[model samples]
Target: MTFDPVMPGIVLAVAAATLLALRAVALLPAARAGRTSVARWAVTTVALLLLVLAAARPVTGSAAGERNAQRPQEGANIYFLVDRSSDSAIPDFGDAPRITAMRSDIEEVIRAHPDARFAIIGFAARPSIDWPLSADAWSLQPAVDALTPYPGIDSTEVNAAAAANILRYQLISAGQQFPQAENLVYYLGSGAGESTVPQGVFDTPRIDDGAVLGYGTGPGEARLREIAGQLGLPYVPRRDGAELPSDRAPESGTATATDPATAPQPTELYWVLTMLATALLLVEIYLTTRDLRRTRAVRRQAPS
Candidate 1:
């Protein structure tokens, strides 16, 4: 984990040392009780260590962006904030969903802006980064292409907060002001129903990455057509009042579009798996607290 703060690990290690030292002062009964004190101290220290590691913000195998050092690139730092909720999986035109088309468009932007660094943000199932800002279009395209909205994370409510988070992440990763003041900040999803941003993240400075590549058209309606009941998918338009339809509108419900069941889209979601590992740890802490309380109660009842 890369520690951005001054000696973040050292500070955390020192804090742990201090806690161990503090435990040295516990009452004799607890301290001397059958290695109970030693075990308690060890457990607490490990928990603190884990939390510190997360706060340290260690990334996955340092991205080359750190070494890139910002050379002159042609396009601006282009980013995509995609909706990975259930709706993204539905069809848009032929067989593919609007989200699929959106990813294709993003890749096109990456290709067109070869020099411009790129990053992606998944807004649902926990807002996070799919890849760091970099110029490698090949790597970036796959990462963008494989994204699938996590189960139960669909939010049509205009999530400016999530969008802002996406915007901030891209610019910061690029390590400069966005658009070079002439480019665009892109948002891809349905921002039609959301009324309020609870965290007020929109108030912050946001680079307008041009227009919106919204996934679905109207409210509650996400449409896509099948390709002759075959393996290909094309765009199917949804005429909803909330969105400004894309120039490449989906064919009407009656039109016959081709559905090419393209290879199953790949989504790199290892981070979500990491969070699962943490749950076991929470159970450990709970057990520790329960045992500690039971010991105290037993001591209280003993006759001196």
Candidate 2:
């Protein structure tokens, strides 16, 4: 049993005991004649005790159940690995830069999965974590919105070595960061460039579910498919005015997000305690009033 009290449980217990003691001192005289005061005290004490217990949020469950209650509801982690190479700045999807389209797509994905955890990794000359694994999607918006093309590179192509290295590192990091969670990786890029790293050199983590999402319909599209094939993930290419593949993104209104950590579920036993307390209080009031009326009738009938 667990009790989450407004004040410490011990403090409430002590206060309840003190109040009972004071009530006994005031009501003990009636105990000798009719035991009425003693009955009232018992009912009042029980009611007050139940109130305190309810306030404490007493819960009874197995150790494992209790542990699960404290943790967030199990959900998938959706990690976005975006390309920040110079090639991403190329004007592709309807006059807007590829990065612009990527950012909009990322936001759309975020809005689609209101309940999922999200992380962002941008790779170019070097791969870096734009946002670590987090439940707060709002915090990731600025990073994704502020994405700029990596500068000072000799070529406008994606750096294969940097992309591969960053991808491997972020995958390993995500595994460490959320070991128990299921992860879905989304690789967003043109897939047109070549990495100097040899094939099969970079280690791809065992991803549970993912998709390789490519932007633009240029030469890099084939390279993107190749990369997806190499990684054993499904490839989905985006074009101007085309809908994203349904399999890659979730539909609207299907997000099942977890409530805040401290929010108790409907199954909590506090409600039962409250009901019991109310019943006891009502009984105590009725008994006390009846006893008072009986005493008054006895006094009125006595010789005076």
Candidate 3:
């Protein structure tokens, strides 16, 4: 059993204690008068405790199972290095902006690897991690959709390898953390940028699969192909109305995808605890009402 409290543990504890203390004090006079039975007080106390437990959001699972639930099972770790340079806004691929092709290709990659963990790093004048590596792949859509090219007027020279160092560090860290998981890198760009390809940046064996998807027509297209060759990834050019080929074979073991039947899922006990608390509260209410009616009858029978 574990707890993922809706509120801070200390705050919940203090609140529960305060409520329990107040309830005890409020029932003291009734207890002395014999109007509130010990059973009623006991039931209410238990109910209050149960209510607190429910709020704490308890989950039942083994420690190992819980850890497994948090970590991605044997699946690819996909890193998307997107160029948000001013050139990316140039409408060249079938009269659509390079960003449009980038978005489409990203979605296609995501769909191709449904179980893969995804991360996004967008670069223009500089690089920034738009999203961290996570199993929730669909959550990355909004971030990708919101990407806009860096303002042309104020834009500095965007280099192809602007995010190379960051990508290297992330790949190393990910390799260390999840050695069994394959690391895939997708570089999406118009390839119209200063060629600052760092030496041996893509030399790491961590990169297992992915591609360099170039957009638009320019002399930089050759540079993009060079970048793809250095990374030992496929180079796909997005020409007029050209879409990414869908026939690419899955590289990793598809059978290794996390099976829902065997996956460790936290058993939420909050609702169960809540139901018990409700039942106890109802019993407490019934007992209190019975005691009130008995007191009223006794008062009526007494001489003035």
Tens digits of per-residue lDDT, candidate 1, 18-136, equal 76676556535556775765565555555555555544444333432332222332345556666666656668547777676766666666655544557677764346777655544
Q: For candidate 2, write residues 182-274 as lDDT tens digits.
A: 667778887645444332223578776777888876667777787777667798887777766533443566543342343333235767888
For residues 1-304, what per-residue lDDT tens digits would candidate 3 score against the true structure?
7775655799999988899888878687658767446657778888989999888877677753454555544567899999898888888767788888888888998887765678899987578898877655544788879987877522346677667878888898788767777888999986654445432235555588888988875677887888898788888887766767653464575555444444455566887999999999888778779879999999999999
TM-score, candidate number 1? 0.44
Error of 3 at 94 (Å): 3.4
Number of the top candidate by lDDT?
A: 3
For model 3 the local lDDT of residue 301 reads: 100
lDDT of 1: 0.50
Q: lDDT per model, in order? A: 0.50, 0.69, 0.75
Candidate 3: worst-modelled 10 consecutive residues by lDDT: 193-202
Clashing pairs in 3: none
Model 1, residue 108: distance off in Å is 1.5
Worst 10 residues of 2 by lDDT: 257-266
Off by over 4 Å in 1: 1-74, 154-160, 169-183, 192-201, 204-209, 220-304
Give me the candidate number with maximum TM-score: 3
Sort by TM-score, best first.
3, 2, 1
